[model samples]
Target: MGGFLSFVKKETLHIVRDRRTMMIALLMPVVQILLFGFALSTEINNIDFAVTSPNRTEAVRRQVERIAANPYFTFKGYIAPNEIDNALRSGRADAVAVFADDYDRQTAATERGEPAEKAVQLIFDASNPNNAAAGAGYMQSILLAGRQTGAAAPETRLLYNPQMKSAYNFVPGIMGLIFILICAMLTSVSIVREEETGTMEVLLVSPVRPIRIIFAKMIPYFLLSCLNLVSILLLARFVLGMPMSGSLAGLVGISLLYLMLALALGLLISTLANNQVTAMLISGMLLMLPIIMLSGMVFPIENMPGILQGVSCIIPARWYIEAVRKLMIEGVPFADVLREVLILAAMTAVLIGVALRKFNDKLE
Candidate 1:
């Protein structure tokens, strides 16, 4: 225990002295958090729309004018009935609201339960989901306020998202996986680099035991990584306004477990690799790719192909992402995260054991 504490102290000192490691552990998370939180958003606003109201009657014109006045929509111009297809095909319009001659008659007949001769056809480019959702929402609001005041509300609602915000789904997972990558993968290479440089040899030959050396190397990075985690959480909540519906303590606890897993993975990589460059290549390709691809950070795991979903089961990042998202976004209790936490702990223990055995072999 004394040797471990002394080695931890030495490792912390070494990390603090190394400027590059400091930058990676501290700066990368802040930059990634800000970029993903602010720069990438699926929220739609000021969508372009075109109308081809050929009826040209006073009533039809007035309704078109009302829709144009809505802030949620921006009308480009009118097109001929035939040109509506050309405009939509050429990507000149997201939607074209066309009023047939019987539109006015249809309005009156719809109240009396009789189908009219012609209907208002809203032709839209259904390619972009965000644009389509925004267009549909704006059109529905316009029709509801202007025409459907007494109409019965549609039943059997299927919510697009209960929260309907991009961050509500994305930020939590991004934060978790990014933290793991920055802290674990980045730190792993730095420590392994020292071993390859003969500097680690000098320390091991001195009074330092293997356990102390590992602990010293880890403590500073562990603290710095924790700071990075805090920054991500703050950005998600205070800046992006993503709700932290669960206990902060629960999140921090789970985060610590994940960090340990990352640190252990780093230690394991450093132990096995011949040099710093090899450590980085191995960590980035073998660990980082699996984490980012399978972790549900950018894509839904449920939507993945059967083989990919099965592959996701082995990804530590996937478990970490799910655990942190549930804790922070959905407000899942610590008990709910317990199974994931246990899995992470088990993985960490296994990696640490392997790393220790490898380190001992190197020393011999």
Candidate 2:
């Protein structure tokens, strides 16, 4: 017990003495949270909308006023029908709404249960499909609200995230990204550094067993990564206004499994790499890109090409992100995320087994 405690203390002191490693493990997560929280967003707002009315009746003016009052849209003044194309082409407007001359009559007819021609024509610039789709939906809502009678209107309700805040989606993804990068990259580099400095041989020759030495090396990083995870969760809940609706214990358990997988992956890299620089390169260049691109962090996996979707299956971050989204945002039960949990557990076991075998072979 005394020897184990001394080894843990030695590893802890070594980590604390290294300023660069400390900054990467501590400061990087905070910076990434701030960057992703503020800058990265998918919610559409402040769209430039142009309107044209041929007759300019009081009813048309009233409808226009309602459209301008919407928070999502900024009215860009009325445009001529001929200028509609130019408005969209020049980026002067994201969409154009042309009211028919008989808009008032058509609306009144519809209210009286009479069949009427469509009262409005909405032309949108589909250059950005997401923005176009959201803008069109917003316009439709405005039109429906402007109607005098509510009897025939369809009621829409958004679940899970009613306001459609992008942070709700990004926070979990950023959590996965930070954990994987920090644990894997830092562990790999730390292990490789000992090899480069000829210290690994001294440790191997010590009274401690090889497996015990490896655990001693890993203990400090595991604790540090746990601290980082707690810090991220606090920021997400208190600072970013994202609430955890699921079981806290479940989240912690899943996160710990993911961290273990990351650490083992790093150990594997360290065994394969000849030096700290090579380990860093492999962790950053190889792992980071796949985590970001194929993990469904920024893009929906369903929207990707079939081949890319198949390729994304092997990326561990994908499962972690999906599990977090289900637990944190959707408030699903542990049973719902059992598949993700099993996959992560399997990954951790495989990585740890392979890494241990390689480390023992290297020692021999």
Q: Evaluated with lDDT, which candidate comes out highest?
A: 2
Cα displacement (angstroms), candidate 2, residue 11, comes to 3.5
TM-score of each: 0.85, 0.91
What is the number of residue pairs that collide in model 1?
Answer: 7
How would you encode candidate 1's per-residue C-alpha lDDT over 1-364 as one tens digit per residue?
6777766676677777877867766777677667766677666656667877766777777777788888767788988888978898887888888888777788788778886665577777888876886778768667656765374755344343354567666766666666666666666776777776778778778776766777677777788778887888887788878768888898888888888887887777777788778887887888777767777887789999999999998888888888877877678678998889888888888987888888778779
* Model 1 TM-score relative to the real fold: 0.85
Lowest summed-lDDT stretch of 10 residues in model 2? 147-156
On the 0 to 100 scale, the lDDT of residue 223 in model 2 is 94
Question: How high is the CA lDDT of each candidate model?
Answer: 0.76, 0.88
How far residue 77's Cα lies from its native spot in candidate 2, in Å, is 2.4
What's the lDDT for candidate 1? 0.76
**Candidate 2 local lDDT, 1-364, one digit each (tens):** 6767888898889889988879877988877787777776777888999998899999889888998998899999999999999999999999999999999899999889899999999999999998999899989888888885766677778888888878888888888888878789888888889889998889778887877877777888889989999988898888877768887889999999999999899999999999988998999887889888989988999999999999888889999999999998888988899999999899889989999999888877
- What stretches of model 1 exceed 4 Å from their correct place? 1-21, 44-46, 56-72, 126-146, 149-152, 155-163
